[model samples]
Target: MTANKIELRSVNVTRYITPLREGGSLPALAEADDDFKYVLKFKGAGHGVKALIAELLGGEIARTLGLKVPELVFARLDEAFGRSEGDEEIQDLLKGSQGLNLALHFLSGALTFDPVVTQVDPTLASKIVWLDAYTTNIDRTVKNTNMLIWHKELWLIDHGATFYFHHAWDNWEKAAMSPFPYVKDHVLLPQAALVEEINDEMIALLPDEKLREITNLIPAEWLSWEGTNTNADAIREVYFQFLVQRRNNANNFVKQIQHARETLV
Candidate 1:
C-alpha cells in the first residue's frame, strides 16, 4: 500500500439531496461545504463504523495497486442537516451520524458495472480478484460487483463489505490464514488466471510501515466500537498485525483461489 497519499479531506455536509436506496446502509447523495457531491455512508449505520474503516483501507489498498478509486473523505454531518427530511428513517440516520462519517467523492453519470456487458483485461481482473481475496471483501459477486465505469475506465467502489472477519475478533488471528471460499463466486475469477503475480507485487509493496500509515488514517472515534474494550490505538495495532500476518501468509489465500479456479474451469 505504498502510493502517493491523498490527504483525507474533511467537509461539512451542507445539504442532503437524495438517498441511494440500492445501498442497504442508506448512503445518501449530499452536497458538502467543499462544493462537491459525495455518497456519504453514515458512521451510525447498522453495520457500524467497522464498515467505514474497511472502506478506507480497501479503497486505499486498491489505489496502491494502481486501481482507480474515488477520493475518500470524512463527511462532516451537522446534527440539524437532516432534521427537515420527510423520511424519518433517513432523518434518524443523519441525526445519529452527526460529527464525521465516511464518504467518497461522487462520480456523476458513472454507470454500475455489468459483468455481462463488460470484459475486463485478464491481468486487471486478476489484480481486482487478488485485492478482494486479500481483504476478504464479500460484495463483489456477480449479483453486486460494486464497481462503476466512468470515462471508459473501471473504477472500484463500495468496499464497505470488506474485512468481514473483523466482526468476530475473538479468533481473528486464527482466521487470518483461513481459506477464502467466496473467491469462487467472485465475478472476475474466471478471468483472474494471473492472481499470483498480483499477490507477489502487493506483498512487496505493502510494507509494515506503509500499512501502519493506512490504519493511522482511520479516525480514532470510528475504531472505538460499542462491544470492544480496547482503546482506539490498540485496535489500530490489531489491524496492523492482522494485515502484516496476512501479507506474509497470502500464499494460503492465493492457493485457495487457484484451487477454486480449477473447479470453475
Candidate 2:
C-alpha cells in the first residue's frame, strides 16, 4: 500500500482453464500455483508484449491514483507446460508465450459495468475519466466499459488498450501532450462533472518518481523484440518520459475532458 513502491506478485501457471474468447489477446481463466484462478494474458497474442506492458503500466498507475484495480501478477508459463494441449491453436500460443505473462486475479461473480443501471458520482466519474484520458486508453468506451462491479464496488480492468502510442514508439512526445479526442466517447463522461475540481488532486498523485516506478515494473523480456534497436532500459526510460511529459501537461487532456463533457451533457 506504499505510494512509492509497487510490486506485482509472480505465480506459475498450474493449469490452463478455458479461454475467455471475448478478449482479443486470447486471455484464459487459468489456475496458478497459488491456488487462485487468474485471467491469463498470453505474450504471443496479436498485440504481443506491448499489450502486456500497457496493461501493467496502466493498471499500476490506476492503483497509484487510489483507484480500484484487480491485483496484477506475473503468470509464468514453462516451455513444456502447454505441449500436451489438444487444441493446436492454444498449444502454439502457449509455445510462443513460454515466459512471463500478465494476469489479473479473477474476480468471481463480478458483473460487467452497465451505465444505465448504475450511477457514479461526479467525482468518481471525473477520476475515471481523468485516468482514461491520461493513459490514452481507448477501450473504456460505451461499448466496452472495461469495468466490473464486485461486492457493490467499481473495479477497473483490461487496460491493455492504453498507451497505444507505444505501438509505433516514435511519436510518444507528441502523444504525451496530445488531447485525447476519445474522451468524448468515455462511458462515464456525462457524469464527470467534477473533472476540473479534482484535476489538480489527481495530477499530484503521478510525479516523475511515480511514473518511473510504474514503468520499471515492465519486465526485461517484455521489452526485447527482434527488430527493435532500443534496449530494455532505454525502452523503460521512454515510457517514463512519456508519462512524465503527459503528467506535466495534464491541462491539455483535462481541457479535452471538460469540452467533451460539456458537449455530452
Task: State the C-alpha lDDT per candidate.
Answer: 0.87, 0.92
Q: Report the CA-based lDDT of candidate 1 relative to the real structure.
A: 0.87
Q: Give the runs in model 1 whose Cα sits over 4 Å from its true position.
A: none
The segments of candidate 2 whose C-alpha lies over 4 angstroms from its true place after superposition are 1-4
Worst 10 residues of 1 by lDDT: 1-10
lDDT of 1 by residue, 111-205 (tens): 99999999999899998998898888988999999999999999999999898878887778976787788888999999998988777787877
Question: What tens digits encode model 2's per-residue C-alpha lDDT throughout 124-226?
Answer: 9999999999999999988999999999999999999999998888878999999999999999999999998998999889877788888889999998976
Name the weakest run of 10 consecutive residues (lDDT summed) in model 2. Answer: 1-10
Q: Judged by TM-score, which candidate is best? A: 2
Return the clash pairs for model 1, or none: none
In the order shown, the candidates' Cα RMSDs to the true structure are 1.4, 1.3
